[model samples]
Target: MSADETPQGYSIFRDTMADMTFPEIARAAERRAVVLWGLGVIEQHGPHLPLGTDVYMPSELLRRVRRLLAERGIDSVIMPPFYWGVNQVSGAFPGTFVVRPEIVIELIVDLIKSLKKDSFARLFCISGHGDALHNRTVHAGIARGADEAAIAAYFVGAPSFFARVGIAADDPHILPTHSEVERPSRYFDVHAGKFETSSMWAAYPGLVRDELLPALRSTDFGVEDISEWRKGGDHARAKTPQGYLGDPAASDREFGETMMAQHAELVAAAIAAQVGAAR
Candidate 1:
């Protein structure tokens, strides 16, 4: 677990988990002060990215962060990903697997409780979805649950304590870019937007569609502000109407790599704060 033995230098998820026995894994967890709990969803990420995009991003980020921890002689393990979240928007979409907010809180609380029983002390939840507010609330729920158990918990969000020194709140699109693949232009696609498209292109390039973005129409819910940005707004009809938010016409791999690098750094710094020698 020294500074040079980080999982970032090598791929952990891609590698087999069989290498470490239960005792070995538990031993590693006992020696470490922090555990990263990834929360993602099996919902639509525009047409460009796979339904598993949410799951992949956090795991990838953790891989890099682990590398940094190894550099600092701090060892942390990425817990199994929790793939269910509040996904009301993508309910109309084929692959969307929505979980009620209450369920999210309870299930996460149970997971943390179980982990605490096993000797892990601190927990961090890293999530991605349309429900930022809901996710933050869920984070709070986990923290409260952990507190009841006398453990600490936090969320790795852009504006939270883990903020990267130079990263802007609006820089590098948070969602995907769902349009064309070549020479993509930056469009106002927030849901099925260009940023998401670029990210999907980087992670699962074969899943993206290069044409048919301009024809999409906007799906405005009657509730205006309240319903517009939610998962129920218009997920199934992204290509026909407003299924996505950003324009995916200009997405490319280069932008994806840059975003990944930045995101990984932020994740690493956050994990460092948790696993660094000081704690």
Candidate 2:
């Protein structure tokens, strides 16, 4: 299904916790339905894409994943999109809102506590941002939340994040790596490049500045450049002057759609496995 088309009988107001009344949410919790949360960051994705790119992508993925879950007879509820995420790498950008890692951790822990209080036993966090520190912080938050609240919670994100944070590849909470779903431009599509630009084009076309795409050039960011970019602030800006890493001009809606679909499938499968194991 296209981004513009909603599945028949699918209602956001009915599926999301934010839109439901206290009694409805209590009933969902009693049913032991998994709670889904999209973890996003308000960061710059070049001039062509909106600052909410991270939020929109994960929220869209969660929507698709929720449908897939329902098709499998698994019930789930979505929380409102959480966009106040750590943005260390893109802090130099004008629109990026960088928060302390501890703040994210505390907020997540509190969220889990509140859910646990409501009798919710499971939670799944899906993030669109790929910054190493951000992912690590989120993982830490989930870990802490599970321990403190005695709830089963998982963080789903890029497989590389596990290795970056010293988690084993086989870690149950981390989504297993799927080579089949890997992007063709994974090497260079680090930031608001062809990969993300194409994604926004497919998922939120109106938010993308299509006219600016033609003039945007691609930057061949090498390992050394990435090392500098990781420093963030001035160092990152020096490496990516225009605030993007890859070729935005090469973006294609079809590519974005395929990528999103494949990723949603992987996420749904992972969530299903985790839910079963928890049960």
Candidate 3:
């Protein structure tokens, strides 16, 4: 689908909270509409992709999720994208904007509180960025918000994130995928590799610099290399001088669409289960 085209039955103005008026929002809240919020970061994603890749990817995924929810007879509200997130690993890159972890936590807490004040009870925080610290901070914020505001808040993320924080994959606050999205370059495509490049191409082809793909080589990193890159600053730059990992040339739009669709399926299923159980 093109950027301007909405799905057959989806209406952005009616479903998106940011586009709704106070009365509409109040009505949605009365109907127990679930809120879907996309969390991302402004960071470099190699030479070929735009810096807003993180924001764009999750925003697109959430759009698909919203459509899927509508089809399942579920009411939902999509929040405006939140891209000001912590970017610790890629902070060395020029386009990266690293917010303080405490600030991110505070911002998330405030957002949740505001939603509660507006009578929103259930929130799903879906993030495109996978920085361990960033995920942890967001989780912390959600926890605090749920406790203080008495709202049902969930952090939808990968199993790796839940594992990293020592939280069970099946935790009540977490909606993790059953497994990682299967792809040929799964291991090496850590950063702006084939997976991300293709995803951007499929969703927003105009934003991607396709011409640069042919000339760019892959920067596949092993475990040791990843450890070095995680150090940030000079270490990360030294590990990925070109500011990307994996082979962009290997990206395929079809694979991107498949991967995103699979993810949306998993996320939509999880959301449906929660919504049903609540009823």
Candidates by TM-score, descending order: 3, 2, 1
Q: TM-scores across all candidates?
A: 0.73, 0.91, 0.92
Q: Pull out the clashing pairs in model 2.
A: none
C-alpha lDDT score of every prediction, in listed order: 0.59, 0.82, 0.82
Candidate 2, superposed: residue stretches over 4 Å from native: 1-15, 170-172, 177-180
Candidate 3 off by > 4 Å? 4-15, 164-170
Q: Write the per-residue lDDT of candidate 2 for residues 1-279, one digit (tens) a residue.
A: 445454532232334677789999999988888999888899999989888888888878898999999988899999877788888888978989989999999998999899999999888888788788888788888889989999888787556657765666766556653543666654466899998888879987767899999999878777777888888889889888889988999999999988889888888888887777767
Per-residue lDDT tens digits of candidate 3, residues 125-205? 888886778777878888888888899999987687689756666666777766667767545676788988888888778
Model 3: lDDT of residue 277: 87
Query: Tens-digit lDDT track for model 1 on 162-193?
Result: 23222234422121112212323333344556
Runs with alpha carbons beyond 4 Å of true place in candidate 1: 1-20, 160-187, 206-227, 231-242, 274-278
